[model samples]
Target chain A: MRSYKDIHNILLDRIKGGEWEPGALVPSEADLAREFGCTRVTVNRAMQALADSGLIERRRKAGTRVVQRMTRNAVFEIQLVRHEIEQRGGTYKYLLISRSEEKPPQKVRAEMGLSGDNALLHVISLHFADGAPYQLEDRWISLDTVTQARREPFDAISPNEWLLREIPYTNAEHVFRASRAEPMDAEFLNLGEGEPVFVIERTTWLSDAAVTHVRLVHPADSFRLVTRDQHGTAL
Target chain B: MRSYKDIHNILLDRIKGGEWEPGALVPSEADLAREFGCTRVTVNRAMQALADSGLIERRRKAGTRVVQRMTRNAVFEIQLVRHEIEQRGGTYKYLLISRSEEKPPQKVRAEMGLSGDNALLHVISLHFADGAPYQLEDRWISLDTVTQARREPFDAISPNEWLLREIPYTNAEHVFRASRAEPMDAEFLNLGEGEPVFVIERTTWLSDAAVTHVRLVHPADSFRLVTRDQHGTAL
Candidate 1:
């Protein structure tokens, strides 16, 4: 006999296949049980799981309905720069501007939950797509966690790409905001000072251990971060 | 008899409880089955579910381990303005600046996938948080979907809130970007022109019926949209 998981998959396929249009009422548990030759309890389990995933809506009077594909919230992938550029059929390039061992700035220290006098790897790099500046990355790495990162030549590979291969992180935090381009950012990203820019700040951790903190800036009109559904609809 | 889902929940509790830290290898399926008093197949099913959710990484020779929490993507809620302000312990105020029926601009019409000559209800409103301008809202409502909206007084309730209560929309598309504050937006948001602004554009639909399109703009320093995991970590 097929389990509830199987039933769940079947129903999910139906939804993904557009078998039931959004907002259309689906069969009740009893009806579904009869159709699948299963107990109502099994059908209920399947339906409940669907509801939890926001694929369906159930009410006492309304029964079950395929949820109108609402503007969905999607977890977007933190894509790799090389992959993003390559996917767009552009030549990808990386430039390591500077690398130094220095005390982290106050804000970086606060975000990493570090106190005074802690040394960190401060690195700045530029990523290009089709020979045009794509993003400017400013990063700080925890020297305590990945000690070997201090010696690796970052000119060959971006710090982010290198860290991913060397250390494994278990948690990450990301912040998205808008900012006017500073003079330094303007020089790197080739945008005018004070132009609107999309800023992404990320902190990764290995359990409770802070691994790295990075800030990426992209020119507003040139780049956009998108989240979407399986049907390619913006979510 | 307990189902695989019960085993799944038990394992999930262990992960949440920090019994196995991120990047720690989990016990094999056979061992898990022995501990839980279940078949290995049941344990496998539970493990598979966890892997699907990005909680665990499974490899052929290396075995399963807690996934390094990479930069996570999250779905952001298109929250109500009143709820947001009230939650933040501020007074919520709304002002209807203008209301008219007119043909949408080319860009707006293109986004809604509408052709020429269709009249939409255009509305401009400001949301205030504690007597300060919180956001500027420019909206276009499709007259075909909600005919009664033409006569409803918007002075009392914002169009977004009203749509949520009255209409049964199933889908929405959202675009988040950064833009320079235009002259009108600078005046409305109490910011200097050319300052950065976070902009969110959303299009809501009832199945195939386009319902509304709205653009919300907030001053860069005053507002930010955040996405996070349940643990309050940014995702």
Candidate 2:
């Protein structure tokens, strides 16, 4: 018997192959079931998978249609520094330049939604790929959320990898932009002052409580963010 | 009566609420069905939705578990330039700087996988938001894929919006990076030479044929890409 997964693949092929075409309302589940010589449940399962993948639009009353103006989504699973480097066949190294419990700056506080008298565990580190500077990391962990981080030895483990193992977060926001390398960034990344740098600011939350804020900087020529959709090939 | 969506919400709350916690194996579908007074199919539907949303991971033998290292995804609906500006309360304007049918540069040909003797429709345009230069777009459309574009009037409509309406593509790749504005870019964007510029290179494909390649450059301080997860508040 043809499984629902087979039907799902067939439907995806039709969408990508332009056989069904965009903005075309798909036949009802019952019709699909009859065509495939399967039950309505099997066809529904395939349709649901397509809908979840953002390939089709489904309505309770209006039925399902291929998205008119296809909005492609690039989904990326944020990975660890070590894993990211190792996956590219480069040896990974970590260096902790500074660690202290101090009051965050106004920008950090604003991003984390912290008010007066709030202090965070601020840590600055450098990550290396194949003995070259890869990323400059400036991170702040909420003392209220990860209390154990106060005494944690960051030299042995980067705060990012440590927190991933210790605390679980439910929400996050990522902002991507380009910036000129400041003096401090130039020194750390071994780049000239005013060189272009790719920047990413991530704020993670544990439900309603803000957990950590991190700023990662990379040499413009060295790093880029790529996202790929599963329905098609990525180049 | 409670539906699969109800079960999905309840399970998500438990995961995000820390009741189940990360890396914790969830109850089997049979158990969940019994508790919800429903069939295994209903519980399966809820579980499938959770897995699709990256809230949970499933394995045949190990069963389902709250993801240990939470990786979030940001989905963006690529919209028209006019809509993007109008939605932000800015008047949209378009200027076609240049349009010609010519041999594409080597880099573009390489990116598009085009061979010798093949020419493309090359277009350069500026998108303005509220009388300010918002984005500088350099685009190339494969004549083989979009033969109708040769005679199109780009002065009235932007090529990006035009292609989206004319041709439906199946695959795309987006590369986001930072660079210093060159002299030409500085003049076009009204920015100081060597200032940081946010660059996005997008290549779209239809089935196995490459359709278009575009590079969009924006002032770093003026634009940023924001991605948010569906389950949480957008910050």
Candidate 3:
């Protein structure tokens, strides 16, 4: 109860005081509980909360240790389309192909937390890096979440920009997976059948309510994903 | 300098000791340098490294503050096929469809960091979940890296299994994207040519060099990538 909150504050105070530096091992659950004069579960809850905040790394046998800063967040920040284009030495361009209304599928309905068989504003477009095919984006928008979307013409603007302008979002869920090239996908993406393609699907939300679900696909032969890693030693 | 190593150790020590709690601002470069009795570059290196490790958040104007672990490295240990299947509430099954050596493509050769044009042991296979098309995997192995391949009927065994047994890997990089289904990709995945699919590509390394690359594509509507957030965060 209040003791746990006090424990949390004490723990935060110690960390802020630089007593437990990054990559340093803290006391075990038992040790923490005994020192704080509280049950182990309370200590466990505090430590778990700290770990969830990205302050420490937990290992089964090695116990928990603070993480080094070098191992932090995806270095590039979610692969901004602009940086990706510049890296290829190409000027990035975007075009909104079309926008239409349709009922969302079961998954989108559930993911977006839509109650009824609600209709969504679907936007399709192409992204080009140096005047070449970069990504084919097909997105479904929940009009209930963002009413402004119903009036926007996605053609003159990219769906990304359009969404960012018209909607204020709280969180986003992302999923990346691979799949084979479909004929329509191939025609839009300029690939042959049986060809491999890279796909990234992202869903943005406002609290527990989902907002937009977008699928961005790239021809496998045309894209590369890069990230820097610390040479093992991250807890 | 020997102090540089001690610097990382010390910084980590303070954080774990609770002196640098989550969201607490850190000392400036000049101040840290003065404290460590090292060059500003050394402190910069240390703090930069700390920031990189995700122990602290830094912005031009916001200064540096202890970061909470929002992401917490959802370290998905994508298991071997057997493990993936076993976890899926189904009987695990694997089949090796084809194998051969081919002159690796220019891009693939580059990915493998191979010199000039080289032949690669191409392994193709399919795994089943309850006798349904679970996954269609296409993999390319560096012949020069692993010698155990020149012989064996992989029909009963899987390349994923063989790789784990015969090859020792030190690192792996994964990417996911979405694409339209092609005829072959559609047929194998049991989807229409225009259907969307999820694709994941993984490159495995033995030490610093790549040993193999694999591409996995799944029917989009069939499944969703599942993960729980460590933060009370959505997305």
Candidate 4:
């Protein structure tokens, strides 16, 4: 029986030595088992492990091959707003566009587990990094859960950063999608209405109580959204 | 004392009844305290809760104002491949492009935690759902881990679907980006180079060991990728 490491090394040698070149068919497991005098299961395990590691490709009956790509799998971390921009060597800026008191939107109410016409505090703003529009955040705050919100001027800071520090949200939900900007959105984002954008929507809770819901829009051409998982498991 | 539900209902009545309109500021906490005949903290709780629900907007020095929105968030769930094709009532087809055995490239090594020239099994494939061109999958597997890879044929079934059932992976990392497709990629995906494409790169790990890495390219105009989280938290 070949040691696990032995399987890894010998296979790697064949590939690197060009015995098995890119786009070339490989020998069958039966053949390898015959040549190495090992069990097919061991060969299967090694190959499965390799395929999992992104070293080679496997299919039902088509066989495995090499991948040539300009980009590999990249793990992305969700960033706090301030950190999101500073990492780019750009200054962060927040602008308060508008604010109001109104009934919660139906979807927001449903997501927050609120009954009909729940009063909500709504805030609209834009986030800029280095003088360029980075994100347009349109949000609704639950006046019922947060006390300090009444006295704050969002002009100097963002609700997200503030909530992270002062409020402890017990839960949250997030949604991501791609769409085009509208006419008003076009002007605000400095692009045409039909231009593509990346949109992220989030709802936070204070324990079982819903806290805040926000929709953030960013130019799709300019940025990418990233998330990482452990194979099938989320990171 | 007013029941929490009562507090929520009363506040909602005032907002929707136009007692507080969009862009119009809300009453002071002290005023609300007087009107509700509740303790300042109770009023605070209600207001805070409302803000959290996205029913209203809050600011530091600016107080609370009704929100005016230029955009509303839309959520889309990324669909599984099988569901995608069957939805169109088309028979899904799989084709093997190429397969080979070779040493892992330097970049692949860096990402996979391997040192020079590890043997690998590589495969490239085209997926057609409903008998039409759908996607192009480029993959790499480590020959060292799965020695049987030398013999597998991927013609009828996909490596992704196969691996999902046969091997359980512990971790995965994903990245989504927009890029212009090159000539070869365009030919495969049926798009011209410099045409925008939505690219997703994925890497999987089993426990601490790297298992597989894959790059899936989709024509941007062909379909949309979606993921959903219910709370403010990303799923």
Q: Give the candidate number with the greatest lDDT.
A: 2
* lDDT digits (tens) for residues A1-235 of candidate 1: 8788889888876775568767888988999898889999889878877775677889997799987643345556666787788888999999999999999889998888776568999999999998989889999999998789889879999997888655666566778889989898999998899888999888877767788999999898777676543322222
Ranking by DockQ: 2, 1, 4, 3
Number of the predicted model whose DockQ against the real structure is largest:
2
lDDT of 3 at A53: 48
Which is better, 3 or 4, measured by DockQ? 4
For model 2, state the Cα shift of residue B6 in Å.
3.8
Clashes of 3: 57
Q: Which ten residues in a row have the lowest lDDT in candidate 1 chain A?
A: A226-235
Models, CA RMSD each: 5.8, 3.0, 12.6, 16.4
lDDT of 2 by residue, B40-75 (tens): 989998888788667789998789998875456666
TM-score of each: 0.78, 0.90, 0.54, 0.54
- DockQ for all models, in order? 0.31, 0.50, 0.09, 0.12
Model 2, C-alpha of B18: deviation from truth (Å): 4.8
Q: How accurately is candidate 2 docked according to DockQ? A: 0.50
Stretches of model 3 off by over 4 angstroms after superposition = A1-77, A97-107, A116-125, A132-136, A142-157, A162-171, A175-199, A217-235, B1-77, B96-109, B115-126, B132-157, B165-168, B175-201, B215-235
lDDT of 3 by residue, A72-189 (tens): 2222134456556876688988887878999878887777667888889999899898887889988998888777888888777787766654454445666655566778678888
The count of backbone overlaps in candidate 2 is: 0
Considering summed lDDT, which 10 consecutive residues are worst modelled in model 2 chain B?
A: B226-235
Query: Candidate 4: deviation at residue A204, Å?
Result: 2.1
Q: What C-alpha RMSD does candidate 3 show over the true interface residues after superposing them?
A: 8.5
User: Chain A of model 2, TM-score against the native?
Assistant: 0.92
Interface RMSD of 4: 9.8
On TM-score, the leading prediction is: 2
